[model samples]
Target: MDVALQALTVLAAIALGVRTKGLTVGLWGAAGVLVLVWVFGLPPGSVPTSAIFVIFAVVTAAGAMQAAGGIDYLVGIAQRVIRAHPNQVTFIAPYVAWLFATGAGTGFVYYSILPVIYEVAYGNKVRPERPMAIAPTASQMGITSSPVSSAMAIMVGLMAPLGFEITNILSIVLPSTAIAIGAAAFVQNKIGKPLDRDPVYQARLAAGEVTAPEPVDIGVASASAKRSTWIFGTGILLILAFGIFEGLRPVIPGADGPEPLAMTTMIQIIMLIVALVILLWCRTRSADVPRAQVFRSGMSAIIALWGVSWLANTFIAANEDSIVEGLGGIADNAPIFIAVALFIVAALTTSQSSATIAIIPIGITLGLEPWQLTAMWMAVIGLYTFPINGSQLATIELDATGSTRISRFVIYHSFTIGMLVMAVVSVLVGLGIGGIFYG
Candidate 1:
C-alpha cells in the first residue's frame, strides 16, 4: 500500500509536468525524483548516462546535417518522389515518413516533409487526414526500426542480457511495422468521404474559406548539400550494416579476450564522427548547429529522459521485490498485457524513447522473453494517445479541409482511429513474428 501510493505520487508529478510541456515536463520529472528521495527516503537512481550520450551524438550529427541543408536536400528528393506519385499519396507518404525518420533517427524530421505530404494529398483530391494522420505514426514506427534511434539504442542495450542482438530486434519490428502501416493505410483510405463529397470540405471550399498553402522552397541542392546528405545517408546505412553484421566492427582485446564493440559505444562514436565529417565536408557554420530543429527537439528528449527515466528507475528499484512479486503472476498469465503498460507510460511521458527508458528495465526483470518484449516494444509509439504532440497538432493545422481536427473532448480526435489501428496491427504482427524468432 505504501509503495503503491508513492508510485502514484511520482506519476502525478509526471502528469502535472506533461500538462505544462516543454522544459517543464523535465522539471516535473526532477521533482518526482526529489520527492522520492526527500519524502519517501529512497536512494537516488543512476542517471542514464549512455542513453543520454547516444541521444546527444545522434542529435549533433542530425543537427549538423540539418545545418548543412542536408535535410532540405532530402526533402527536395522526397517532394519530387511524392509529387510524381500524388495519386498514391496514402501509400507512398507513410513510407516517405518512415524513411526520413529512419535516417534522421528522430520522428521530428517528419515536420520538414509534412507540409509536402499535406499538399500532395490535398492537391490530388485525396483526403488530407488520411496521409496526415498516418505519416506521424509511420515516422514513430520507423523509430523502432531505426538502428540508431534512442528508443532502439536503449532497447537493444536492455535486451542484450537476454541474448538478443540488434539484428534480431530489427528483423521482427521492421516487417511487423511495414505490415502494420499497410494495414493502417488501407483502413485510412476507406474512412472518410472524398474531399469533393465531404460536406464540411465542400462548404468551406464554396465559401472560399480554404487558403492555398505556401509552397516550401527546397532551394536547389548545391554541391555541399548533396555531399552532406550523402554523408548522413551513408552513416545511416553503415549503422544498420554494422548492426546486422557484427564482423564489420573491429574486435578489440578485453578481459574476455577480443570482443566486438558495444552497440551503444558504436552508435555514439559513429554519429559524432559523422557529424565531424559533415562539418568539414559540407562547410556548415558551427553556430547554426544548436539552432537546427533536430538539435532542439533532441535536447528536449534528452532532458525528458534524464528526469523521467531516472525517477522511474529509482522508484522501481527501491520497490523491485514487491513489484515483481505482486505483478509477476498477472504478467505470466497474460504476457501480452505488457503492451498496455507501455502504451500508458508513453501516453503520459509523451516520448517513446523516454517511456522505453523508464519502463523497459522493469519489464526486463519481470523475466519476459526477449522476443515478446521486442515485439510489444512497438507499443511505445503511442505518442498520439494524448493528442497534444507537435506532429498531431501540425497535422490538424495543415488540413485546410477542416476534416482533420481534435474533438472538444480532446481524445476523440482525427488521429484516434489511425492510432488505434497502427498500435493494434503492429503489436499483433510483432507478437506473431516474435514468437517465431524467440519461441
Candidate 2:
C-alpha cells in the first residue's frame, strides 16, 4: 500500500470518529487498525496497556472522591476564596482552577468549579470571560505538571530511554507550567472591557437577555465529604513525594538485589487504595463510582487513546523509513520543529496522550535529546487550540453574560490566547529547565 494512502486512512478514521462523537471514535480507530492489518499488511501495534491502566486507576480514585462529595468540598474552599477576594478574582480564579486540576490529575474536575468562577466574577462586575475562558485552559495545562496524569505517565515512559525519570519531568514542567499559567491569568485580566463597560453585555442587559447567573446553593458540607477530600488530597501528596524521592517507594527483592516499584504499578496501587479507603470510611456508594464524571471522561480518554494511538502507531511504524527520509534533514537541522509537529498533531487528534504515543518515537528515532523531548511534552496541551471539546463547550455555556464565546473563525475562540500563551511559555521554560538540569 502507498504510505500516502495509509496516512489518509489514519486521517479519515480520526475525522470520522470525531464527527460521530462518543465511543464511536474509538471504534473507528480500531477499525483503522484492522484495515491496516488486513488490507495494508502492516504488523499489529501494541496497545498502550500501561497508559490505559494508569488512567483507569487514577480516574477510578478521582471518581470515587467525586461520588463521596469530596469534589464539592474542594470547590467549596475555592468558592470561599473567590468570594473573599472579589477584587482579585481575575487573578485568584485561574489558580483555583489550576489547583483543582493539579490535585485531581485530570481537567474534568474543573467542570464542578466553572460555574463558581462565572458567578463570582459576574457578581463583582468583572468580565466573566476573562477568568471563565482561561480557567479551564489553565486546568488542562496543569495536566503536564500533574504527577499522576496519564499524559505524564506516557511522557515519563517515553523519556525513560533518554535517562529522564518522572522526577526530572516534574522538576522541569511543574514550575515552568505553573508560572506560565500565572502569566496567562495576568494577561487575561486585561483582555476585555470591564463587565459594566462592555458593549455586548450591555446590549444583552438592555434587551433583557442577560442576568446574573443564579447563585449555586451547595448544601451543608458533611463530615464524610471533608474526610474524603483530605484523604484524596493526601494521596496526591504521597504520589508527589514518592515521585520526587525515588527511594521512598518500597523495594522488592530481585535478582539485582532490590528493585523499587515501577511508577505505573505504584500509581495503580496507590489510587486503588485511596478508592478503597473512600468507600470503606467515607461511605461512598460503590455503585456510583463508574457514573461519576471523572470515570466517564477517563473511560472516553482510554477508548480514544486505545484506538487512535494504535492506528497512528501502526501507520507510523509502517511508514518509518519514508517519514525519516522525507523529514530527517529538517529534523536534524532544527530539532525544535519536533515541538511544532507535536502541537499540530495534538490539535488534530485532540488528545495529549494520543499525540505523545504517536510522535515521540519519531523524535527518538531522529536522535532528539531527552530534554528536548521533555520540553516538547508541553506542546501536547495544544489540544485546546480548536476548542471543540467538552471543557471548552462548558465554559461557553456557563457564562451567562455572553462574554465568553466562539468567534466566527473557530480558531478565535475564548481560549485561544491563553492556550497559546501557556503552550509557548511552558515549552520554552521546559526547554530552559531541561537544559540547565539535564545538561
Each model's lDDT comes to 0.83, 0.82
Indicate which candidate wins on TM-score. Answer: 1
> Could you give candidate 2's per-residue lDDT for residues 246-296 as a string of tens digits?
899999987779987767778778888999999999999999999988789
| Residue 171 miss distance in model 2 (angstroms) | 1.1
Q: In candidate 1, what are the lDDT values of residues 291-314, reduced to their tens digit?
A: 998899888877877887778888
Give per-model CA RMSD.
1.8, 2.1
TM-score of every model? 0.95, 0.93
Question: What TM-score does structure 2 among the candidates reach?
Answer: 0.93
- Which runs in model 2 stand beyond 4 Å of their true positions? 252-258
